[model samples]
Target chain A: MTGSRRQRVAKAVFLHAAALVVVFLMAFPLYGLLLTSLQPESVIRSRELSIIPQTLYFEHFRAVLAEGHIVPLRRALVNSTTVSALTAVLCLLVGLPAAYALSRLRVPGRNVILGALVSVYFLPTTIFLIPMFVLLVRWGIDDTVFSLVLAYTGFILPFVIWILKTFIDRLPLQIEEAARIDGCSHWQVMIRIVLPMARPGVLAAFVFAFILSWVEFLTPLIFTSSLRMTTVALGMFRSTIDIQVGQQAAAAVLTLLPVALLMLVCQRLITQVLMSGADK
Target chain B: MQAVPDSPAIGGQDEWTRAPGTLRRRETAFSLSLVAPALILVAGIYLYPAVYTLILSFARFDMAALEIGRWVGLGNYKALFANAAFVDAIWRTIYFGLLIAVGATVSGFLIALLLNEEFYGRTLLRVVVVLPWAVPPVVAGVLWGQMFHADVGFVNALLFRIGLIENYRIWFGDGRTALHIIALAEVWKAIPFMVLFMLAGLQSLPPQLHEAAAVDGATAWQRFRHIVFPLMLPIIIPLMLIQFVWAMKAFDTIFVLTRGGPAGQTTTLNYFVYVEGFQSFDMGRASAAAYSLLVVTLGVVLMVTVLRRYAALRKATA
Candidate 1:
């Protein structure tokens, strides 16, 4: 008993230690990134080997927020937020029933539609990379925020639907059945029964789509050129070459701030999304 | 002639409709109506690009260079085959994919195994572990770029301080190390996702099996090898394949980090298409290159999947 007890304690120590190392490796670069954001560019350029910042600075953040900079951080924030929010709303509006139907309907060609939907995931974005530019240019929406939003919503639809459909499929069909027996119409069954039970799923899909959009680069990179509709992603990329290290790091921080906060708030739902997607 | 079976699938029991014998038709209409928005969006965004690829691949369009389309079918494909840069880009893409897939999957497996235990701060660590995943690719790339900077970069400073090297070595300079660093950043971005998938697989495995194996005098390694390995293979294989697909097609990280630079060391097939179309304005050749890449990627994925299935069959027979 004593030997087993000692071994169990040893195992626990190893587990905790391993977790610490994993956390450190994952968080160190990000910590260094945030460190640069908090410090002046001069200190970073001094080549000192300090991982922690000695003094906190806000000038870089200010410069990013300043009106006349090339990146235009404020416009970018608004543009990114608008695109992300609109993408989320648009995806949910379109994805809810597409997911529902895929999960629960007996429609003809169900498999074909579902199979086609997976094209985005399986194929390289480059297949559409060149052609999409031409297509968008031809559509006369090139370089507009609308073009970015439209492309992102479409790009993220397949994953969003897969997640939401998994959520909806897990719902007990008995209540839906009971609603029908109680003289409920199809709309009532969905609106009253499915919708009520699908709040968490809806939130999950929304947040997932929102994050995917917020982080998306290809659409903004290819879709928008001018600074008027620049996302922080594009701004961050542009800043890499044009801006100082501290300011670019600050931009990275600002871009990641909301995503990190949302992850904390939607921790369980996000985990559920990943796990559910994995299960399928 | 055959009666349709009543389905609780969707569209409530057919009672409020006038068409008594049109149950299938009604269900189809209702499903189609519900899915109309998505269909339209997908059609607009997905179908158009896909269909347009076919036409553009055949026609010559370098309008920016004052060239016009001549509808030379197969000419673009022939040119693509002869293009060394395109071939190099494809190989580089595969090389990057292989490295990232192996690195992320292995690290993810270890982390998932570690996290599967009952421990303190498990939930907190789970959230922290997924922080990298939540990071947007371009930002993540930039964060890494900051780390890899030669003058003030933390990577060099840390290595020098630790006496790993005589001086700070450029992490992203030469063509050789550029792709490796890109792979490293990608591994950082991808590990969380792979961990999530592996954790799901881990949690789904019944603890009873492990317990029974333990009580039957199996060592830990033996128990894992005989029980966990086979069960986890399915999950691991598919997740790894997905990771491979993402790494093979990934552009933003490479674009932001090196822009396929240091003499085009990191120029993936995706990057090649981007340059040809946007930089050179050769939409025809770019389209052809992209189409070829798509076929090869799909073919590789299918081949791997079939090979895995075959191996599984052979092991069972043996």
Candidate 2:
């Protein structure tokens, strides 16, 4: 018995060691970037990259702030937050009902419509990018945050609808029926019974929508032409592409912050979505 | 995992049990109202322009053609198919996509298999695994670009020290290496998402099958081959399909890293569309190429669906 117990412990140790190696491999790139953010340009240029830079200091962060990263970041944070929050809110407003209809109320051709909606997004976003640019230009909303919001709402709505449908499918229709029997109006029953039950899913939908838009790169890239108008993600990209090394590294860190925080806060919920299965 | 919002004990009991009266009609109207805004939004923003892209493809809609909106009747598509560069771009897109699909599947399988074990520091390991999934694709590109840059590159330095090379190998300089390097970055960025789906599938698996197989003197490989793989197909198939499409559409990593450089060797269909339409102002041809990409995606999806159905049918019969 003791001999097998030793083998069991050995197996556990081996498992842990292998897992640690994987964790290190996965985390190493970002950690390397963080270390790069601290190093001076000269040391960074020496071509001897280490886990921790030899001449590490806080100067890069200071330099990044001194450059235009801080101001644009402020605007971008506000812009990203507002657009994402609004996207989430708009998605919820429109998505909840569609989801409810699909899940509960017998809307004719609902399955076909839902399937079509999903398949539409499966086509490359580029399929829409060119025409969208033309459309937005004609509408005169090009280079504006409103256009970004509308574009994001359109893109994220289907995902929100899909997720909300999953949630609403799992919800009890009897409560809503009970509310209807109790003389509550349809919208009222939705608000009072179904919506209350779906709060967590709604929040998950909102948070994920926010994160996706917050980190969105391409739409903002073409849609918003100017630096002043673009997102933090765009700023980070420009900082890197333009070879603003110190600022680029710093901006990389800044770009990661909101997403990291969101993941930290919402990972449990996110994993639940993952755990539930990706089929629908 | 967040508790699933309380489900009523009643199974599949729906809201239509009341009556087939005027009240039901009112409910239908309300439900239709509820779904109308989404339909409108989808139709206006998504559906409209997609069809417009079809129109724009067929018509001469370049700067000069923008004025006339003249119909060209397969002129753009003919040009696209005739262009060797565009045709080549199609092959490059599939090459990169297959690389990513295979990489993501293998690494995701490994990570899932590892995490499925009862290991110490499991939560911490999970966080580390998921860290990349949280990264903005742009940031991931930038970060990896820094590591792979010719001078001051970590890849070169480490490779040299480990005796993998005698000199610094410029990872992104050669056309041959650049595309694969970019694909590698994409694979790294994609691992977390793949692992998430895989872990979900892995966790849902029943361990009793493995235990019983082991007791029957089956080797580990046999058990996995004969049991785990078949049971895991439902989850892995959808995840891999999604991964294929995503990798095909992926633009950020390669764009940031190479911008389809070294004589446009790394350019894919997605990039082809962006450059042709936005950069070159050849709206008509770009639209044609974009539609071709869409067609390829649809064709793949259709093929895979049929294949999976056939496999399932065969298995059932067997």
Candidate 3:
């Protein structure tokens, strides 16, 4: 018994050591990015690399925020936020009803429609970019934030519908029936009964759509030319080409912040949703 | 038909019944009202653009020719097939998809298995694992690019310090290494997402199965093979297929890292389409290429769905 216990303790120690290695490997690049962003440009260009900053230079952050061609950065952030928020709202506006129909009402061709939407979720958005660009140019909205939002909605709606539909399907149908018997109309049942119950799912869908739009790069990179319409991702690309490492890192950190916060805030729900989505 | 006294039909409600006409009408209206907005938005934004791209593929709509261009039928597609660069890109994309999907899925599953253990600071470790995914793909690409820099990159710095290399090597200056490096970047950036999903799958699994296996004196490898692997397959297969499709369309990472550089060695099909459309302004050819990619992606999706259905049927029968 003692021998077996010792063996178990040895295995535990080995497992813990392995876990520590994994954590270090995963976090090292980010730590390096943070440290590099804090170092002055002259120190960064020096022959010898310093693992730790000798003196903290917060000026890099100020320079990134104040000095460089920040107009594009500012515009990109605004555009990204606007496009992402609009996409989320639009997705909810359209998807909630479709999900309700799928969940509650027996519509003709419902199964086929659901299957088609799910398939479209797997389809590559890049495939549609070329023709979408042409159509946008023809309609004179190619480079506009409006086009970006539209594209984001189209790209994201299928996933949103799928997620919401699953959640709605799991809801107790008897409650809606009770509401109806209480003399509530179908719309009333949806607004008063179903919507409140599916709040978590809706939040999940909104966060998903928002992140997708915010991080999207291809559509904007191909369609837009004006600096005013660039996204944070595109802004990072421009900064990299301009060799502004500090600004690039800062932008990278900023872009990551909101999504990280959202994930932490809704960790359990997001985890469940993401797992279901991946599990098919 | 006799009215059934407030008894709503449970299963087979006829649409044209006179007794339930009011109920039927209300249901129809509700259904239409619920679905109309989504249908319109999806059809207008998604379906129309896809169809329009198909049509553009068959036409010779160059900018110089403008609206005066003639329909060339399958000429654009034919030209794409004949173009060596395009063909090469398709092969590269397939290779890239296979490499990164397999790499990310396997490594991610391993990491998930590790993280699933009851260890101290597990939450902090989870955060660390997911950090790469939180960083925007563009930023991740730039970070990797910086790391691979020959003169000042941390990668080279570490290697030189460890005496593994006599001098810093130009990692991105060569075609062969450039594609692999970009693939590595994609794998690193995307593995965290795969791990998150796989970890969820692992956690959802019943621990009693492992306990029972252990009681039966099964070795660790045997337990993993006989119990864990089979249980996880349901989630693993679908995630693998989706990851494959996503990798095929990977662009931002490659774009920021190499810009499909070192003489177009790292250019996947998606990057090829972007270059053709925006850089060369060859809308006709780009649309054709994009259509082909769309067809392939759709084909893969269909295959995955059919596979999932088949698995479900088998499980039901068993």
- Could you say which candidate leads in DockQ? 1
Q: Which is better, 1 or 3, measured by DockQ?
A: 1
TM-score of chain A of each: 0.92, 0.89, 0.92
What lDDT tens digits, residue by residue, belong to model 3 across residues A1-280?
9999998898789878887887776777777777777777777666576887798777655665553465366667778899899999999999998888776776767777777787775656666776677777878888898999888888889889888877776677778777766667677778899999999899999998998888888888877887767887787565435646665666666676777777778878887766655544
Q: Is the docking of candidate 3 incorrect, acceptable, medium or high quality?
A: acceptable
TM-score of 2: 0.92
Best by lDDT: 1
lDDT for B232 in candidate 1 is: 96
Best by TM-score: 1
Give the residue spans of candidate 1 off by over 4 A.
A1-10, A239-241, B1-19, B62-68
Query: Which ranking of candidates, highest lDDT first?
Result: 1, 2, 3
Model 1, residue A264: C-alpha shift (Å): 1.1
Q: Write one digit per residue (lDDT tens) for candidate 2, span A213-267.
A: 8888888988987767868787655433474565577778888888888888988
Q: Per-residue alpha-carbon lDDT of model 1 for A1-280, expressed as tens digits?
A: 9999999999889988998998898988899888999998779888677765678999999999999787788889999899999999999888988877777666667767777887678777766656677767777788887888888888999878877777887888788877777777666677788877988989988998999899888778877877777897788555435778898899889999999899889988777666665555
lDDT of 3 by residue, B81-197 (tens): 999988998888878887888888998998999888877777788888887877777767877877787766888988888899998899999988989988888888888888988
Q: Candidate 1 clashing pairs?
A: none
Off by over 4 Å in 3: A67-71, A239-241, A276-280, B1-18, B64-68, B295-318
Assess candidate 1 and give its lDDT. Answer: 0.82
TM-score for the second chain in candidate 1? 0.91
